[model samples]
Target: MTKILIIGATGMTGKSLVAEALSNGFSVVANGRNKEKLNALKSEFSGIEVFNKDAFDLVKTDFEGIDVIIDAFATSPDQAYLQIDLAAHLIALLRNTTIRIGFILGAGSLYTDESKTQLTNDLIASDESTKPWRATPENQVYELEFLRHVKNVNWFGVSPGSNYIPGKKADNILVGNDVLLVNEQNVSVTTADTMAFKVIEEIKNNNHNQTRFTVANG
Candidate 1:
């Protein structure tokens, strides 16, 4: 069984990844800083081993015996820069190693049109209703920028659609390389479970190496 470690396992995406990995018979090592949430996760999935440590403090030794590490780390909009910092830290730690690193990024990094206009620009120009959370997506865009330069470690990035919500798996999914994905109804959304399933499939298949991809409900 491939030993997989998920950072931020207590978050919404992280929890789904944990469940998906376990259901597929992978050995899961869940990492989170909150002891209470970690306990809750352990209760929900009895078989998973837990790692209680801040992502910034994690050293290479902590990843021993792990084949893949999924960085699902998340933070509030005001502190969104931590996203890039964490990605850099992980890439530095795993440089030149065979361990595959997967980053859960936002769709802000995606191109919005054929001209390659990034979605982050439009997001920054959006209305006041989205004022507080804009930084989160902006920082996620920066995170992807950082990863694109990394050439040593095995890395792949997964970006959810415009509307990423908590829900069960979708009946159909559409994958894309860079531009934001939308369905015939002109809806751009992805359920947490659907994203988790696709990500796990990529990990198992080892395709899309050293690149990023986006997904949406079809």
Candidate 2:
């Protein structure tokens, strides 16, 4: 059985990922800052191991034997710097591990065209309206750069649709490479369940290695 560690397991997307991992028979180590929520999840899932610790406290030994690390943690809009700091710390902590790291990232970084500059400008502008969303691609770019230079650890980052939330599963998710994928309606969206499925699917397939991409329903 593959062992997986999930950071930010109390959030909506994180919760769905946990459920999907459990259903797939993977051993999960769920981490969250909230003690109550972590305890509740522990009580609810028979095989889940819960950790109520801050990101800074994570250690290499904590992730020993883990096959993958799913990073779903985020900071508030005003706390962008904090998000970068946390990501740096996480990268440093896992530097020695041979495990793969799968980051649950925001969609703001995806490109709609061939020119990389255009997509970057658009993503930065959209960040204003998407303030409530945490860890925009602007911040993740640096995280990705750090991860790329690291040795031994394989890293993959996935960005969900523009409006991802708790919704009915459509079972129709579109996958793209370094581009913003949208539906026929021109509005990209994904449910938590679909996003979770993608995460598990990547784990099983080992696709999109050392890169980031976006997902939506089309």
Candidate 3:
């Protein structure tokens, strides 16, 4: 079995990744900064190893036996740029080795159309109702851009659609490259369950090396 480590394993999407990867019989480790939540996950799920350490503090030894890493780490809007910082940090750690890296990318980076641009600019310009959370998507876009130039590490960035609801799997999942995917009702959404399944598939397949992909529910 492939030994995998998940960063931000206490978040909603991270929890789903743990559950789905366990169900698929992968050797999984949960990494997070919150011991309480990590303890709760341990109590709720069997066979999951937990590591309570800050992302910035992780050293190469921590990844000694890990085959793949899922970067599901999240931060507050005020500190959203940490997303890029963590990506850089992890990239630096895994620079020449074969250990693959995966990311739960932000939806704001998805292409709004064939114009070859993304929605982060418009989202940043939205009204004050979304005032407190704009920096997150802004920083996520920066993270993806930085990862695009990395040549040594095996990386994949999976971006969820417009409405990313962190819950059960949808009946069907739609996959796309760079573009915003829409269902028949023209709504763009991706559930945490579906995202987990797709990510684990990518981890196993190694089909999307150093590329960014998007997912939605149809």
Candidate 4:
């Protein structure tokens, strides 16, 4: 079985991904800053390993024998630069390591068209509406740059659908390169479950290496 490490495993999407990984028979090492929540998850999923640590502090020692690392942490939007710095730090630590890295990116940075940039704010108005997600900084751009400069590491940034929320898996997902993929109705969304499913699919297939891709339900 492949051993995988998940950063920010207590978050909304992260929690779902952890459950999915366990269900798919992957040995999972899940991380979170909150000990209580992390412990709760551990209790909920008796088979999975759990760690409480900050993202910037993660080391190969914490991931010994791990085959892959998934980053699901989100920095505060007011400190967007922190996300970039964290990516750089993570790349530095994983530079010579054998573990592959996968980032759970925010939809804010996805472009709706080749010439037009359609960020997350474009879809949702008012900070009150996007309060929860908007508080988290997005680094789709910097994450890609880090991958380009970092050698000996295979990395991928997976952006959720434009309107990600908790729901049943639609299984109607569209996958694409740098450009954001949306449905014919010009709206896109994916359930936390489907996003987890897609991530595992990419990990298993080793697809979209050193690149970023957007996913959405069709």
The number of the candidate with the highest TM-score is 1
Order by TM-score, highest first: 1, 3, 2, 4
Error of 2 at 162 (Å): 1.6
**Residue range 64-164, candidate 4, lDDT tens digits:** 78998898776566776767777787778887667788888767667657776665545543456665555453445555566667667778888876678
Off by over 4 Å in 2: 114-117, 120-137
Candidate 1 per-residue lDDT over residues 60-134, each given as its tens digit: 999899999999999998999999999999999999999999999998888886578657437564767778788
Per-candidate TM equals 0.96, 0.88, 0.96, 0.86
Superposition-based RMSD of candidate 4 using all C-alpha atoms, in angstroms? 3.0
- What global local distance difference test value does model 4 have? 0.77
Clashes of 2: 0
Pitting candidate 3 against candidate 4, the one with the higher lDDT is 3
* Model 4: lDDT of residue 89: 77
For all predictions, the C-alpha RMSD in Å is: 1.2, 2.5, 1.3, 3.0
* TM-score result, candidate 4: 0.86
User: Per-residue lDDT for 122-207 in model 3, tens only?
Assistant: 65547577778888888888899999999999999999987888777878889899888899998988999999999998987878
Off by over 4 Å in 4: 115-138
> What TM-score does structure 1 among the candidates reach?
0.96
lDDT of 2 by residue, 1-218 (tens): 99999999888878888999999999999999999999988888868999889877888778878888898887666666665677677777766567888887766666765565565426656666755644455676566666567665577888777677886556678988767778889887888888888889899998787787677776
The pairs that clash in candidate 4 are none
lDDT of 1 at 94: 98
